[model samples]
Target: MQLVLVRHGKAEDPAARPSDLERELTTTGRSTVKAMAKGLRLCVSGKVAIWTSPLPRARQTADILANAFRVKKIREHDAIAAGDLEVLASDWRDLDPQPKALILVGHQPHLGSWAERLTGAVLPIKTAAALAVDLDEDSALSGMLRWYAHPKVLAGLADR
Candidate 1:
């Protein structure tokens, strides 16, 4: 299965928001994420499933991806926000009808850490960046990093 890890777009600072989970994506965040999502659409094919952190920022990002991918629904998974890599992997393994591609939208360090754990590459998962991993069929915990790019690069790709 192909796994796409997407960091949520730039959001309001924690200090400005009463709750971290409530922090909304800024206007620029929405625009950049839309561009990034369009670029991602060029790289993906077949049935795609979108999973997202429940936090407002992540959910908003996921919504943009859903529109780009033309997927009607987004699945909100707590593990993505909680940074429980094990549970996320297990859940991926247990998907009854696995999608050809799974896109996960979530927050910072966690997304970067998960990418490193899966591909053994310490990637800088910038805001609105995306990393694509080809998961080994036999091992849920391991994968190859097919590609990684920040929003600028991805947005550039959208033109191609």
Candidate 2:
């Protein structure tokens, strides 16, 4: 099985949005997510499962990809961290794994931090970027990073 962790697209600054939960994705963020979503569709084959943080920015990002694939609507998961890696992986392992690809849409530090914890390397996954980790067949719990690409890169790829 594969796990895909995605940081939500860029959002209005904390001060600008009326409420943190109601903040929407910026124009740039929507474009970037569209490109990234296209890249994911080209790269992975299977029914995709998507999860998102409770925050509005994440929900907006998920909306950008709503037409790309059949996926679960955004669900709020507290384990998706703001800066804690432990929470990301801890929540990941604890969650039930289906046979298909699982995508967790969430925030920073937690995304990169969790990748570091799992792969022992700091992967700077940007807004709307995704990282795929390969789980071991023996344990089926832990994993190692296979590859990760940033939203910018995916957008570039989509432009080509």
Candidate 3:
């Protein structure tokens, strides 16, 4: 299985909203995410499934990805927001016919922590960052880090 973990793009200052969940991506954030999406689209092939947290920022990021990939629908999964690594892994494994690639869009520490747990490597995923893990049948935790890309790297790819 291939897992692609993505951190939500830069969002409005938390202080700007009473609730953190209400925070939306800034203009720069959207542009950065669009670049990241373009880069990702080049690498991804076949059927892809996208799951995202319900939070505005994550949903916005997912929307960009979905559009880039031309996906008909984006699935919302609570485990993405809850940041339960085990549950998220289990959910992925449980899919009847697993997708060729799974893209999960969510927040910071959660996404970072999930990547660490999966690959046993401390990967610092910045805003609009993405990490791709290649997992054998054994366990999600045993996956290997295939590639990691941030906005800067993706932006360079987008320019070509």
lDDT of 3 at 29: 94
TM-score for all models, in order of appearance: 0.97, 0.81, 0.95
Model 1 alpha-carbon drift over 4 Å, by segment = none
lDDT of 3 at 100: 93
* Tens digits of per-residue lDDT for model 2, 138-159: 5444678888987777667666
- Stretches off by above 4 angstroms in model 2 are 18-22, 81-97, 138-141
Top of the candidates by TM-score:
1
- Stretches of candidate 3 off by over 4 Å are none
> Which pairs in model 2 have colliding backbones?
none
Q: Give the TM-score comparing model 2 with the true structure, all chains together.
A: 0.81
Candidate 3 clashing pairs, residues 3+ apart or interchain: none
lDDT of 3 by residue, 1-160 (tens): 7899989899999999999979999999999999989888877778899999999999999999999999989999988898887888888889879999999999878988877777888987899989889987887667898999877887788679
Comparison by TM-score, 1 against 2, better one: 1
Clashes of each: 0, 0, 0
Q: What is candidate 1's CA lDDT for residue 82?
A: 90
**Per-candidate RMSD, Å:** 0.9, 2.8, 1.1
Worst 10 residues of 1 by lDDT: 12-21
TM-score computed on alpha carbons, candidate 3 = 0.95
